[model samples]
Every structure is written in structure tokens, then in C-alpha cells.
Target: MFISGVHHIQLTAPPGCEPDARAFYIGLLGLDEIPKPRSLQDRGGVWFRTGNCDLHISPRENDTPPGTNWHVALRVKNAEALRRKLQEAGARIDPAPEIPGWKRFFGYDPFGNKLEFLEIA
Candidate 1:
């Protein structure tokens, strides 16, 4: 009865992918990386912040490949520009998006995590 919006969305990354995650989430997506607490930093993961949302990336227990349709949709100011940035970074981008109410597209990070970006109309 008292649940607020999501405090954070935690996604799994394979071990030792911080550089790749950093490149995609920060270098490409433009989210600002945050420092994990000293107690948790040794666990091997990364954190990011955008507005009020905190994104936490941890090591996957199974370390399997990412699947289609399982992705995080981020509201962006200019989705097209981000898509172009992804292309230039050599990240795998899905075909042109066809969703309503948003100019959007999907892209995968170097470690094969799915991410979606959309600009709400």
C-alpha cells in the first residue's frame, strides 16, 4: 500500500565487464557512473545514475547470453542521436524502431545486454 516508484533497477553482467559496461552505459548512453560503496565495490559491479533512477549492474549467476525483448527502456531527449552514437561505437543496434509514442531503438552493450532508448512525444 506504500510502494513508491522503483528505487533502482539491477541488471546482471558477466564478471569482469565493467570496462565494457562503462563504455556503453556511460560513454554511449550518457548515464553518469556512480561509485559503489567500499563494502560492495569488491563484488565486481558498476552503478549509474540518471535523474532519480539508479542503475546497478552485477555479475550474473549463470552468465548466459541476453535474449530478445528483455530490455530496459530509457526515456531519452534525442533518441536518434543516441542511436547514431551507438552505431559509431560499434555496439550492436537493432533495426529501426517501430513503436508509437516514441522515437526509439534497441542496442546491445559489448557484453550483450539489451537496452532500449525512446523519446516520448
Candidate 2:
């Protein structure tokens, strides 16, 4: 089998916590919010667009699992700068070691989902 590219990556958010999700995803992460279709509007959640990739968060009946191992790694321009911003916002940042060619770290989203951001080092 052959695959071209990723369409989107989704993570679960706690129910009725869109405000926290927005604050972390849009406000801190710098990802622009995307409008959901009419069909999915009432379901409760949010979507964001980052250049060519789309990130979707859906409401879950339970809380998101907290972990540093399982996560979504995003390629970025300046990982250090973003890491600082995250620290300033009272977000949890993990001291992840250097990845071969990348400056990397881990930060947990509002719903406790782990996210990895890296830039070419």
C-alpha cells in the first residue's frame, strides 16, 4: 500500500470545554481556528488549520489521557520560541531530549493531550 500524505490529526477534548481548548490551541499554539460544517456543529469541538495540515478536536465522554510518549509532532519554524511562550502561559512543558536533527519538547493541551513541537536544529 502507498500513502500520499496526512489528511488530518485528531485528539479528544473533554465535553463542554471548548473555551479551554480555544485558549490553548488558538491562543497559545498559534493555530488558526476552522469552522466546522453544519452537520458537525452541534457535536461540540473545534478545528484548526496550520498551513497545509488540519487538526481536529472532538468532544469525548471521558478525559484525554496524559502522556509524553504518545503525541502529535508538529514541524515548526522556531520551537524554542514557542516553548517559551508556552511556559509563559502556565502550560506544562516537558524537557524532551534533542531529536537527531530537531529541537524538540512536549506540551500538554488544555484537555491533557500531549503535543510535541519540533524544528530543524
Candidate 3:
């Protein structure tokens, strides 16, 4: 099987919550917002870009299932600062920043989507 790199990852959020999603991902985590194609705006969503990875958020028609392990991970220059920014923005820190070969930490978005950051060494 020949497979190229990941094209993009799409995550579902409860309907009409794009603003909050934007606040958390863009306002808090500091990921750059990518403009979605005009054709997709009516569907209600937002896009974020970090290096080659794209994170797409779409409105969920139904409740997100329990125990779903979907998430997006980002690599940053300083995991501790990122974690601090997230904490200051009122995000719940799941795993506090730690240095185990790589400085890292984990947190959840407004809708409980898992997010992690790792410092690039």
C-alpha cells in the first residue's frame, strides 16, 4: 500500500459552536486560521494551519459519541508557554507540561476535543 502524508483532519463540534471553537483554537492555542473555501462556508466550519497539517472543524448534526479518541497534535517551540497560554484562557489541562526527552503537554478544546503540544528539539 502506497500512502502519502495526511491531507487534513476534520473534527466535529456541536452545532452553532464555531465561535467558541475559534476562540479556543485560535484565541488560546495560537494556531493560524485558514480561510475555508467559499463553497464550504455554508456548511459551517473553520480551518487552522500549522506547518503541513490542517485542522478542520465542522458542525456535528448529532452528539459526538462518548469515548471517541479523535484529536489533533501540534509541535511547538515551547510547550510550557503554550500550556500556560491555554491555562490562562480557562482550558482544562489534562497533562501538565513535562520534559521527558521532549517537552510536552495536553489539553482539551472548548468542546472537549483533545489537543497536545510537543516542543521541537
Candidate 4:
């Protein structure tokens, strides 16, 4: 039981898509951008601070298959409001089934990465 909690989650983005990634993760999602180390700066990726954890987006070709269920579940304050916001912003929203003690939904980022938003009930 050495692992305590997650420090960061890394996801891939298509090469040369830093602007698009920043637009979505920072402009749309409102995540605070963090500076990357000098050694990694030239790698072409962005890092974000989300609550207690960090999210790293590396520049690479994403080969995820269609309909893949892989996703990062992010805890949110108001799932309904965020769902509407994402919907209004032209992001795809997928309704999720009722789960005990949780209100949740799935949405896709600009990179086609599935993200689950949940609010504890």
C-alpha cells in the first residue's frame, strides 16, 4: 500500500495540437496552466492543475479505437450545470445511468478523449 493517491493523469494529443488543447482544457474547461520543466518544454505538451492533481497532455498520435470506454472520471461541483455548459460549447455529451450516491455524465474533449463528470450525492 505504498501508493497514496494519484499525482497526475497523462493523456495523448495529436501532434502539433497545443493550441487546440489549450483552447479546450484551459479556455473551455477552465483549468489553470502550469509550467513544464525546461527539459520537457521542447516535447510539445501542456500541463494543467486540476484541484489536487495534475493533468498532463503529451503530443502524440492518439490511436484510441472508436467506442472505447477508457476515460478519466473527474469530480465536479455541479454536474448538471457543467453538462449543459459542455453541450452548449459543442462538445458531445452522453447520458449515464443512475448510480447510487452519484450524479454523473460522460463528455468528450476536443481531442475525442472521454471524460466523466461526477457529483457526489
lDDT of 1: 0.83
Clashing pairs in 3: none
Query: Which ranges in model 3 have alpha carbons more than 4 Å from their true place?
Result: 65-70, 96-100
lDDT of 2 by residue, 1-121 (tens): 6988888888998788788888988888888999999999999999999778899999989665745478888888888899999999999999887669888998888777888888888
User: Candidate 3: TM-score?
Assistant: 0.84
Question: Could you tell me which 10 consecutive residues in candidate 4 have the lowest summed lDDT?
Answer: 60-69
Q: For residues 10-101, what per-residue lDDT tens digits would candidate 3 score against the true structure? A: 87788898899888878877778999998889988888986788899888877573463555777888778888888888888877455667
Worst 10 residues of 1 by lDDT: 60-69
TM-score of 1: 0.88
Candidate 4 ranges beyond 4 A from true positions: 65-67
Model 4 error, position 69 (Å): 1.6
Clash pairs detected, candidate 4: none
TM-score to native of every candidate shown: 0.88, 0.91, 0.84, 0.92
lDDT of each: 0.83, 0.86, 0.79, 0.88
Tens-place lDDT per residue, model 4, 7-100, is: 9999887888789888888877889999999999999989999999999988887555247678899998988988888899999999988999
* C-alpha lDDT of candidate 2 relative to the true structure: 0.86
The predicted structure with the larger lDDT, 2 or 3, is 2
For 28-77, candidate 1 gives per-residue lDDT tens digits of 77889999999998899899997788999898777865567788878899
